[model samples]
Target: MSEAADQHANAHTFIGAIDQGTTSSRFLIFNSLGEVVVTHQLEFKQIYPQSGWHEHDPNDLVNSVTTCIDGAIEAFERQGHSAKDIKAVGITNQRETTLVWDVRTGEPLYNAIVWTDMRSAELVRNLKKRLGASEINQLCGLPLSTYPSGAKLLWLLENVPKVKEAYEQGNLAFGTVDTWLVYKLNGGARANVFVTDPSNASRTLFMNISSLTYDEQLLDFLRIDRKKIHLPEIVQSSHATAYGSLAVSKLRGTPITGCLGDQSAALVGQKGFTPGLAKNTYGTGCFLLYNCGPKPVISKHGLLTTVAFDFGPGKRMYALEGSIAVAGSSVKFLVDNLGFIKSSSAISALAETVEDNGGVCFVTAFSGLFAPYWVDDARGTIFGITAYTQRGHIARATLEATCFQTKAILDAMEKDSGHKLTELRVDGGMCNSDLTMQIQSDLIGIPVNRPAMRETTALGAAIAAGLAVGVWDSFDDVKNVNTEGSTIFKPLVHEKESAVQFARWEKAVQMSKGWLA
Candidate 1:
């Protein structure tokens, strides 16, 4: 046998991670050292049925995931590793992308309502006026907003006839992307493995952050008939058999284990296990999560409290999260919508054409501002535009929008947690740009740490799965998994300059408010 094959045979078995994200589905195979061995990603269609509405066809989500799994497994086998070498699979997905399906037939009653969808704006507004609405954040760690899965579910229940009929008949199965993917990945109606980790459940606003279970008062407030709709059973983030094995893939029958919402998984992947450690993920949207240790710390700022992860009894942790509604998607807008660049990769180069923003500031609140400023009525706005403002300045400002939000979130985290962050670990597509990372570092006045392996989100799922199945015994065993080839960007701009720039951003945000209202 080849030396490499012999080494693979003797080494610990691989772990597979199914990352079901907003824009794509990816299957990645990771080794014990947290190195990605093989990966396959497929971008599925994003459906926009109306203004401010976003969706995904249920089949597209399932089919794309299965295809990626099969493809990644094929690549792994080509490298002389058998599918049997993959001992377990973990799932990390876009949180709060809500879906409803028939329990009997496993057919979707309506398209999956994306977390970014604003169709529930009016519903959330009215819900905020209801009695006891003010107490929801204290109870569930989330305010009444269109971002939660519960809000989206309510919208479907009130608007979609099929969804309403399924709910009334007690045939409705409601879940976020994680639960739906797990149900479908385990053969849908056949095996019927319906469960969700605390991380995902926390985003639904139905689960109590402290108890980590469905709250009756929350149900009453949302007006959801618990008897009429079936919710996924809450489970540990990492468990040996809670998540069923893959039923239809080359790696069929592999035990499925760890699961976390995408942001939480990124935190795990970055090894943000200690309190005050934080990570920012710049995906379709930007999310900054600060680990607040074991107990939940309710945010005095506009941030939301969420489960960081629930590995088991004594390992549960919570996070203070700041969510930004737009990030890398704004770059896509420049490429696809405005034709400022040929593709997203060209954004940095275009922005580099200008030394600075040149007095331009982009709010990029396409869906509305979230976290620290929950301005639901705000719209995307640009300030200080002039003939001197070229595409580069706009591009620079576009990237700055996310950085500015991260700084704002960090400030909020400091106030809420009473601990200042010294550094930030970053991942996702946007973090690849040097200019972007430097901008982020300068804006936050902290070192921006980027791991050589940017696939921390997938690695996080692999870590969870590995932990459950004994591939790794504990967090300490995987602490040094992806520590090599790290790069840290230190702040270059003076703190005063950064503060002045941030002040301008705050002014723009204030001026941009209530545009929709």
Candidate 2:
């Protein structure tokens, strides 16, 4: 909608982005210019009990949506825009986190299995022995790992009595986070869109990459029966359906036009449409996505060939992704867990207090190293912590951990796509730190570009929704509207020093591996 038309008639409107992620839920209101008029966010609770178990209250996820939406809506009107002017909603969520709820009552059968949860590791290990990781990885474009939803679902069906009972009685409905959030946001118990997109489905280890549908053999392998569980209907990422009307807020008839896994949305938000384009999001964890165009190039170097996005049923794009389990959270760990720093911002100042890492390397594998270094048994380790080391060196090492892991993923991206990364577009909480961005550029030897809008996750969703509803024309138009400002950080570290740092990182990685044992 044009600004002039929007003023004359609140007839045409703004786009709403419902970004439900691993740690928080956010609502962002954006205009045709991709400028965020109003936004509200709430961090949800994360439960960790047993070593590898992670869970979330379904009600918490649901309530956060209502709360954040109301907050954002009020702020929108304060900014002279009507909440009623919102024409459509877009959903981008953490992918492969599975939830099972009753089809009739909408009550959750069990705590939602978080994507970071690894209690299913043993189950996946057994599955690997049975199916072989290579064959499963080839078929699904995903490794036979606990990170995928299929194994987690299988684990739930086997261990959780309520979930098993519901599944057996055919009253269970299964969905990833996006499906669950959309279902609840639209209409809790009655919502029947039981479906998943190809992008999210590809991470499940149950969907075939080429067919973009659940494979019968894979379902058989996971022991899931069609009669037992109501699976959501697969849909395109950019469809104008999936969700409509939320019960709590007395909201109805708002068409949800776009959906994507959070990482893919970041890729799109960064304008990574062409092949060789790549973007890395530094959130709770870091995710690097490299656009590989149409064909799926299965990763040979312990990476994943995930669906970049299903533009629609007629159009599909694919990418190779390398995921790191801990990035910004490492800084949180230093502040909250280790008590080394007072706050997140203190990290850069503390790091700069030291000339370098001072022979320390902190591998922030609180869970495990993901992507090319999938050491499932690995846990957090602080290497080279000699008596000479100070808090500043530790902070520098912690920050360097994120940069080193990112570089590894970038190398894997090069190997998979056969194109070296010339530049990287970055967005997220940590990307705001110039010290970190400089290190990122130095390590990758590429200019690290940052857009003016760090809320690109939400903006990406809004853009997709606007395009679907004909509020925007083409990529060129969205480009003009969305990517308004950009800044670039060029590499500053010497090439030889960078190489030495990388080599020391490799040594530390070797030392850190298998620490969980």
Candidate 3:
């Protein structure tokens, strides 16, 4: 064989990951070594029809994913690799973003209700007063809040005319982003491959977390007629033929073998397979997930119990999750809404210009506070602002808001799990800011470890896909993946000082309550 042919024969096989998030859709191809080979990302429009309402055109999602896959495959071919060199693809998406479409036409009945949207607040409030309301969290591992897809679906069925009509006609199909992506990528109505994994299903409040299936009592309590709407079949997170294949693209016919919610994918990407391991992802929203072994731990605090992942029957794990409703989006608010800087990347620079928060503390409850608080009545409140406050002060306070919430979550996790995390594995956009991370480490009083490869979320989906297709035999086989070039930020302030700072944040949180009331 010629040298070119020899090189081609020795080329590495790759796995592609579709990371559909709140703000963007991304496709990343990774080699067996967990190193990124080629990647493409596309940001789509974020629609806010009114205050506390967020929606995404369903077409934007599918189109962005299709474009990203095509773009990444083109780049992969430009290298010495062929499209055939790519094996199965995986999907990780923003959980609880609800959608309903016609079962026959495959057209969306309404815009995708974003996971952070609060239009269902009134519905959720009434749900808490209904019979069997107290059993919801125990059965589904989620509280009756606007955060779950079931509440969103209920709101749509009651409010949207088209959605109501579809439900009454028995043509409504309910799904999170994962199920929709799978259905569309596999030829939509032609293939009709509608399924979701346990991680995604657990967030819907429609699935029984223990049995990993749809619960009758939950449906009855929510007043959803099971016969009226079609829910996606729950499947394993890693499987060979469950998710089907891409129907049109350069990589058409590639099987989708793995699926996870974005935060669960990050945990897997960080190699947090063992109990007591934890990871925090600083995305559009901040999420801290601590592994809690096979069985779920119902939280006494406001933390949520959820399925971490389900590789197969004996390979499932659970997590205690603390979700912050705002993180990187808060930074975006400064850049776009307040014009504090040119872009999000400039936040750390602007914050570093100030020595401290200058007595300002921003409670970022634009929608409401989530996790350990669940204070739906609170609005975004800034405390201690005076004539001395500058843009830098506000910027620092904005960054501190996320850190403070993270600290509260960690404390709650410790109380629920009876285990203190030694260090935190961190990834996502906000983790790129060294100053913010240092502040996080100081307030949390633990090391914040960030890998050089920050796309752990995508890598996680790739890992799941690769596992099903024999790229790696077991979890142990991939232990060394993505373990190099890590930066660890440790505490620099005294313990007393950190406690005082957190106390002030708690005071601000308490004071921020009742604005929505």
Error of 1 at 353 (Å): 1.1
Give residue 214's error in model 2 in angstroms: 0.8
Question: lDDT per residue, candidate 3, 281-323, as tens digits?
Answer: 9999999999999999999999999999999977899999999
lDDT of candidate 2 at residue 21, scale 0 to 100: 86
Cα-based TM-score, every candidate: 0.98, 0.95, 0.98
Backbone N/Cα/C clashes per model: 0, 4, 0
Q: Which stretches of candidate 1 lie over 4 Å from their true place?
A: 1-12
Error of model 3, residue 360, in angstroms:
0.6
User: CA shift at 501, candidate 3, in angstroms?
Assistant: 0.4
lDDT of 1 by residue, 302-355 (tens): 999999999987799999999999999999999999989999998999999999
The TM-score measured for candidate 2 stands at 0.95
**Candidate 3: pairs in clash:** none
Candidates 2 and 3: which is better by lDDT? 3
Clashing pairs in 2: 194-232, 194-233, 195-232, 195-233
Better of 1 and 2 by TM-score: 1
Worst 10 residues of 3 by lDDT: 4-13
Q: After superposition, how far is residue 243 of candidate 1 from its true place, in Å?
A: 0.8
